[model samples]
Target: METIQVVFLTVLVFFVIVTIHEWGHYYFAKRAGILVREFAIGFGPKLFSIKRGETRFTLRLVPAGGFVRMAGEDPEIVDVSEGQTVALRVKDDKVTRIYLDRLDERSGVVRGEVTAIDLERDLFVSLDLDGEIERFRVHPQALMISKGKETQIAPIDRQFGSKSVGARAMAIFAGPMMNFILAFVLFAVCVQMAGVPKENPDKLFVGSITDKSPASGSDLKRGDTIFAVNGTPIGGNFKLMVDIINKSKDTAVKFDIIREGVKHSVNITPAFDKESQSYRVGISADPQTRPATFMETFTIAGKQMKVWTINIFEGFKKIITAQFKLSDIGGPVRTAQYTSQFAAEGIDKLTFWTAILSLYLGIFNLMPIPALDGSRLIFIGIEAVRGRPVNPNRESMVHFIGFALIMLLMVVVTFNDILLLVRGEQ
Candidate 1:
């Protein structure tokens, strides 16, 4: 039952974050008059669906990710070859719908082997009816049914490319922008719960120990005040102690501290936080905090959000400059595990972790990688400078290859996550 709850919370967190991200895109696309075919949470087999106006909202089986499918966003979306069969829903003597699949299963529609078709441009389908060439006009808002899913046919006007470059860029960029907004909101909530922190370098103590931290398996405990490291007096500078630990270079360092009014010492070896590209003994400062002023909430939240974003960017830069390790990165499985662990501690920790995840999600999507919003924005920039858009087929193929490679990376990373979990490395 506990395991089930963890899985449920994990899914819920992902659902909320990803839905908001996709909603940003959907909202902007709709405003730009683009036909949004689907606003789907998750991927793979559909679990449930409902249509709202021109858009179909859906829930899918996988909890890993979601997408907003904007029509005409991909120029290669509708392709019907000559000599193909199609069932049409005609109205007012004109084609109102096109069924590209399961032709025998559709009733009250005309079945014809298409000889010539133009879903775009002419918006008509030509057929050999009784060996006579006949063509019928298609409706602007014609529905196309394929694999039992109905999507409105995108005329040139309703296509994403037809919009101004600004609209297209906004539609793509809004997803990440929403993520940053969420992180800021969540951080504000956290500040309200826990007062604003005031660093007390002079009064350092063990606040908590992570499960895999070197401090955990050592004599370190909460409330232990450290006064020296390897006989180097801290001298009211917490940074001095940190510098000493970092300079230790994974060597065992002796810490002199007073725990429960008794002077004692402990030896701890710092571990390489390869993911962050830093050396650490796995501890954080337990700073003294005071109640925040009402106005301080927003101010602190913005500052904290900015700090988290900058830190994440720097971490990625270090990871890129250093030797890349597969274990240095976590996939869906590992992230879910971390989410569960943090949530189990308390709502404050959960909120804190969620805010960090939101920032990471926001910043990571802006990396200019293919198939991401960043890459899409780059295309828009190129179009603005070149006075024309890139070839749709070429852009689509590049994104497709990037997507394939990403999926492959997900497989490898997920495998490593499971292996680490089994080996007690997680």
Candidate 2:
């Protein structure tokens, strides 16, 4: 049953995130007249499939990723100007390329030249003034073109760049916007399930201070009750620790502590342990666990949701900046190990952490990296600037590269997760 819970949570979160992402594209693409070939979850071999109109929907074996495959995702749009020949223009540059086939032939190749590029649209809009335009439907290779007697190869246009910039931008923005919508909806629902908490006075007392730690130098001693740090009141250990770590990078904190029924104050610089990605002022708590108010429970959960969202973004930033190594990343295996560890701590702890994890998943999916909703937004932003869509071929290539990089990162993280699980440390 424990294992079942982990699987269920993982699948539930993954499905929610991926569905929102793909649906974003599916919604916008249909509105834009783009033909979607497949809306799929997972990768590798297909586990199940359903055909609806022109779209083939499938659940694949892998649960880690998904895609929305559209025909216009390419730079070249299909044309049948002549019964035996098909022609296409470079979507952005307006250079036309032609392909020829015998009356009985099913496919043929065309050659042409193109110049002038649109980075935002990924289109090559104009060719050399005197260049020839050759269009093709077949013969993907061996296309040629020239200007002023100087010849150049003309590449086929994928329809992605051919669409209006607004259409292209909509397609790109759709995924991230969907993620945000999911997050907002989930957050609001969680809010309704849990109400906001009232501000409670600090009752958590420091039971120990590590020797030679920053807290020791700052006048913090055993049995000191911490009321606030750097002017931020501490309602509990989670809030106190989070506030400290957030400021650990550069700020020096002043602690308002009470000992022996007398209030005293101290200043300490929090130190960062790069490995844990957390901060410490060298003090330990006797785990002053408080009973949640009927209202505090909901508020506490909602606040945690907010904290987890911030943490997820910070983690992503650190990973990108190399402060967090890829080897430190965790996958489902690590997540399960953590779930198991917390489950043994009782339902409250497990439930709290689960809420945090859910929020993490919700926020992370909204990022704009390639193969991510966030990354799709970047493309959308570009289209908005260029007043036209990005070239389909270029867009596909960029995403392909991003996908490869993401896969590599995932492999590393998964290895790390498995290692942590084996050691029973996650």
Candidate 3:
């Protein structure tokens, strides 16, 4: 069914972007000789898994995102809790176990002293004689217990910090770089399928050219043929419009026009329009076709990829600045509906939108916001500049804060998403 296709396509796009993003971390960590325990796609309970060597690859219940869990994340050096109040020595040298009131939820530094050990249950009951007592659960794997300030096991690999600055930078940038690569590939494919749009002089028809606008003062007429903008031959208005919008308000855009078979030059200072955030000489152009050659199609795709990257960054900036709000953002629910609508138009539209969405994901994750690949890179950059790696405890705390903020934002966005969906249904 159409709905099924829409859902399937949306999931495919989401997973591909997420998996590559996580893999970026996993690949570099391995290259740096860091131990990675798990690389999982999605969240919640594991739906399926396969172990390959030391890494366990899992497909989780939630398809929103994924993670590469690397080892050495716990830097506990000294395990000197052997001499305790009630130390029951191992009867058969068997595995020991212990349970805190609730071990799953607690994170951050948990300092405690083990006052008792029940050998039969293999549990180590501890008391917070010094600081806060954090619970720990005993598992099959050898427990890497941390007992307080004295504990110092390099959480991640020592070599991770020991690596050259350039190496660390490369490892950090790899995630975003991979996303850019994905956008480029997708853009190329989309371009090949459908010829790029262009603005042609012969097809120039004004969409809107406001009065008192700079265009009104020029020799250029409404239906005038636009041969080029600033001497660059424009096949279509999309690129030229994009350029105009990105330029400063005071910049004069020159258009070479042919009106009634007579060539003329028009220079107009574009005014900013908030709705589109594009500078306009108060003129719009008719859509012109630019059929791509086989080679040209591939090249154009790469071009579009670059264009999308810039747009994504600008959009995020606008949102952060309060120029846009949560309502302006769309979640997966809306994406699915939009995908279905586009799919109805035909496969070409669906594919094009898919490429666009993919590019969006790749670029957005690269943003230097907290709880993102970009933020991780920023931390890495700090380490590179400081000549010493950031303290793991501090860095983890920062990330936790970022994670919490991200979760709160997600809740708001999801609430907005549901509201929009219900309104549409009504």
Candidate 4:
């Protein structure tokens, strides 16, 4: 039952994050007058779908990722000319399908049976349209159709490629921007509920002691109040005590502590940790916290967001500089595991971690990698500079390759995640 609860919570968190991310693109694309054909959550065979206005919203089987399909985002081009009979599948006055085969221009009407429809590729074919048999490649953009004459083309305003560079950039950038917004909101809520830390300078209270460490070997224990270090009085200055201990580094330091109202002195030597490049006595101090006012909550949350944002960038820099190992990178599985663990802790911790995860997602998506929003912005930047869009075929190919490489990386990361789980790392 506990396992089931964890799994459900993990899935819920993943769904919420992905849905919001994709909705950001859908919202901005619509605002920019770009025709969004489908706003889908997840990938592969869709479990359900419904058409609303010009968009078909869908939920797919796989929960790994989602996407917004926009018109003119691909390389395909539709050409319509005079003297050629084109059969169109119309529904509710909308051109739902287009026939590629040239119709007998003499036939005023053609009839055909619908053979197949490829939703992913947006391709459709019919055996006949009003007695005319033809193959048709469906146009992705929504269109109005009239029977005998040439099919009315999708409006230029509805095409993504026709939008201004600023509009295009906004649409592409909205996904990551929404992520940051989500993180801020979540963090604000957490602060409002749990308050912010209010550190005490005078009192030094040990919260926990690492087992088998120098502090643990001594008379020091959790909840012990330290009044002074060595012969010098701490005078409630926690920083002073910390500075002395850390500066001592492998040197013995005498601590004047009060345990259950009994004054005692204990000598503890600090150990140097290579990873953090810090000296520690293995004792964690309790941080004082107080309820924050509404406005104060937002201020704290904003500061938290800024700090986390810088940390994420620094982490990426470390990875680039080889200071971080790729093997430590977590994928979907690891994310789900962490989400489940945080959820098990309590709502406060869960919300805190969610904010951090959202921030990370936002920053990571902004990386100028192919198949990502940042990569799309790069093309838009080129268009702005050149005053014209890049060749559709070439741009599409680049995105395709980038997408393939991203998938390969995901597979590798996922495999590592599973291996770590098998090895009991998580």
Best by lDDT: 1
- The list of candidate 2 runs beyond 4 A from truth reads 75-162, 198-309, 336-391
Tens digits of lDDT, candidate 4, 106-164: 24333355554342345444444466655555454534344532222345567788888
Q: Residue 55 of model 3: what lDDT? A: 75
Ranking by lDDT: 1, 4, 3, 2
Over 1-426, each residue of candidate 3 has an lDDT whose tens digit, in order, gives 376776676676677777777788788877876656778998789999888865789999856677777554434333334333222112234223222323443343333457543321343444454565533433223323333211112222333555566766666666667666776776676666655556333344443455577676766665667767777776555566557535747788777777788888877777777788767677666555566777887678877877876787788889878898568887656666677666654566667776777678767766777767677778888877787778888877877798788767666766788898888741
- Candidate lDDT scores, in order, read 0.84, 0.60, 0.63, 0.76
Cα TM-score per model: 0.75, 0.52, 0.59, 0.69
Candidate 1 clashes: the total is 0
What clash count goes with each model?
A: 0, 37, 18, 15
lDDT per residue for candidate 1 within 1-426, as digits (tens), equals 277766677667787788889988999999999999899998789999999888899999877678899877675455678998888889998898899998888899888889988876789999877688889899888888788766678888888999999999999999999999999999999898877666553656666678778988998876688888989988456678888988897799898989888999999999888897767888775654677887899999999998998899888987789856879889999999999987665677778888898888878888888988898899899999999999988999988888888778888989999999999887
Stretches of candidate 3 off by over 4 Å are 73-162, 196-291
lDDT, candidate 2, 234-261, per-residue tens: 7565565556746665577777888888
Full ranking by TM-score: 1, 4, 3, 2
- Best by TM-score, which number? 1
Candidate 2 local lDDT, residue 214: 74
